[model samples]
Target: MNQWSGVNALCYYLAYILEIYLGFSQSIALILASVAFTQYAVFSWPPYFYIDRIGRRRTVIWSSVGCAACMAIIAGCLLNSSYTTSAVAVAFMFLFLDCFTMGILPVSWSYSAEVQPLRVRNKATAVGVFSHWMSNFVVVMVTPIGLNSIGGNYFWIWAIICASFVPLTYFFGVETSGRSLEQIDQMFFEHPRWLMGVEADCTKVVKQTAEDEEMRHKAYAKYDGFDQKEKHVEVVHHEEAK
Candidate 1:
């Protein structure tokens, strides 16, 4: 999802695109790129507060829609050489970063971690990290070539890729918000279908039973010389519980 979103492609080549394709001077291109990143940094904070509230699947799906629209608009704008279109393209570039930072930037890594079982989580996370970098490398390597060879049409590829994520996530992705890892595991175990959205059961949060809570308290009290009143027992719950 992260790799094909064309984020790294834009991040690595924004200034180059501005200077070469948009006819901006070197200084102006650099300044605009810097401002775009500043905007990115500022927008990144909102997801920290809302990822749980809005849930991961919706965030990525909607963010992808925004990114695809921005890419399409930018591509269309670049097809013409007028000053107004150039300005629109630049504005959309910043909007693209806004969408990315709000959704994919924060959620991708955490979601990858959340989906893994505890025993193999480290290994799985390492593999995910490796794949992320490899994808980033591919995007960065081909971006210049695509921009130079295909010109503005290159972004159409990204627009299509971004647009595709919506259905892909909607069909295959599970709702991780407000679910404990154990609950998520149980969900997968119970529903073996590849299309998780069909049943929509995973979206429901399972409350911990009173019997289970009592058993946990009894187990904690069994320890010798420990102050049960002061002992902190960390209970993991789904995002909605917060």
Candidate 2:
């Protein structure tokens, strides 16, 4: 996020300088840009097409590439001396930014619902969400200071972070598209860092949750009041004739 948003920061800083240089109404341009962004909101859920078809790993990988491309293009345009170069760069950068909602990172909660087993899935998801938001909080607080201090070279800095995630995804990310808990467990068992604190037994933990969910469902069905009540029939006992 730091690097991804760093591109936007670059656009803003560049836009500020460009506005002063161009002497055209930048405030109006900014307003127009915001309106252009509304188009993205208008056609919401473009990722809905691929989230189920391509799976989380592919979606994340593709979006990671997108963030990289967006930053790189912005950097290239800014590096040029011509004002036209910078303007085109800003336009393209904003276009890409608007489309970022279609990225896999935003739809992760949906992925968790599709992937995790039921019993302890809620617990696992809660922990995962906690870690994600905690990291987001830390990154958002620190990023502005980092970008301001670094100056123009910060675009490259953001590029490096986005680039780093691609390899990490390739090496560590599993294909959870159509796979079940047991398959996910196999993926985890292959890598211990995946589970955190529990080490080797985390695979077992995943499997146990799957089993628990299955057992709970069966138990609930067995005890369903309407069906069970019907199952019970009154039996009259006749005393032996004396």
Candidate 3:
């Protein structure tokens, strides 16, 4: 989960280096890239809406593969010296950014929000944001080195990086669709609980804990440490007297 999502978060950072490579119209291309990211972010929401439905594994796998192809295509476009190359490259690059941002980008945050205990949701969200930006900073600094390479060589490097992330997603990402939240718990946790021959709900861990505590008290039939039969007899006597 961390590996797939972490890489997806870094997609724009990698693309920033590749697409920002100076050329005939570099400044204009960059501004367009920024606009595309904001504008296209909406389309990517379908990925979010359906991620839990279609499942995280498929979404992550496809998004990583698509993002890789986009990078490779951008690199190929940049290699062309045609006057329209910059325009086409930026156009496609934004598409890839949009895909990543809306798709694999939010899955981990969703998981984090759902899985983290309520006491730490804010902290969990903060940590997620922090990790996101930290990676952003790293890629921002490192990407320039790729940019310094000869024309579009940065894209070639990013193409490789993008390609590498796909397999990482396939192997490490968990599927979260269709199954009850309990199944998702088994998929990631150290000790998965089985309830009456079925998996327990992962998302209901806190609720389950409360239920179990109440059940424990009922099972013993002991109010204030009274013996089980004594408690039962007392209840019966009270009912008869009524």
Candidate 4:
């Protein structure tokens, strides 16, 4: 999800795109690229507050929609090949950064870690990070060649990839928000379907079971503490009476 989104392509190549493809002056391209990155950094924070509240599945799905639209618009503007369209393309590029930061940027790593079983979580997260960097390398290497050859048409490829994530996520993605690791593990165990949309009931049952178990443990601990306090008080009274 992270690799194919074309974010690295844009990040590594934005100056190149602005100066080479869009015909901006070198200094102007550098400035614009820096500003875009600043926007990327600033926009990354807002999702932190909302991602869990909105839920992972919906966040990624809707963010992909916005990303796809931005990519398509940027592609279209580049294809038009005029000063006015170039300006519009620059605006959409900023918007694209906003969309990516809000959705995939925050959710991907956490979601990957959350979905793994406890035993293999460390290894699994490492593998996922490794895969992400490898894919990043591939995209970064391919992007300049793609731009040189395909021109504006190159971003349409990203647009399609972004659009495809919506359905792919909806069909296969589990709702990880508010679910404990145990609940998630049990959900996969019980359902085991390629399509996870029907796992709601199973997840609820697992969650309820976990809650009951937790309450039982708390109750036991409370009673144990009470008994210890009573024993201490009785020991003090016996000592005083003597």
Name the best candidate (by lDDT): 4
For TM-score, the strongest prediction is 1
Clashes of 4: 0
Clashing pairs in 4: none
Between prediction 2 and prediction 4, the one with superior lDDT is 4
Candidate 2 C-alpha error for residue 69, in Å: 1.5
| Per-candidate local distance difference test | 0.86, 0.56, 0.58, 0.88
Look at candidate 1 and tell me the lDDT of residue 45: 95
lDDT per residue as tens, model 2, 1-242: 42243434443444453453333368855665565556546534677666656656556667767777776666666555366875676565665564355664454556565456666788888977786667666555655665457533456666666666666555655556545566666655566575232333321222234576688668778879657666553222222332
- Model 3 spans with C-alpha error above 4 angstroms: 1-27, 112-129, 178-182, 188-242
Q: How many residue pairs clash in each candidate?
A: 3, 0, 1, 0
How would you encode candidate 1's per-residue C-alpha lDDT over 101-168 as one tens digit per residue?
A: 99978889898988888889999999999999999999999998888898899999999999999998
Clashing pairs in 2: none
Clashes of 2: 0
* Positional deviation of residue 110's Cα in model 3 after best superposition, in angstroms: 1.8
Judged by whole-model lDDT over C-alpha atoms, candidate 3 comes out at 0.58
TM-score of each: 0.85, 0.61, 0.60, 0.84
**What RMSD, rounded to one decimal, does every model reach?**
9.0, 8.2, 8.9, 6.5
**Candidate 4: tens digits of C-alpha lDDT, residues 132-225:** 9999999999998999899999999999999999998877888887676876898788788888864565322222345766986798799999
TM-score: model 1 vs. ground truth: 0.85
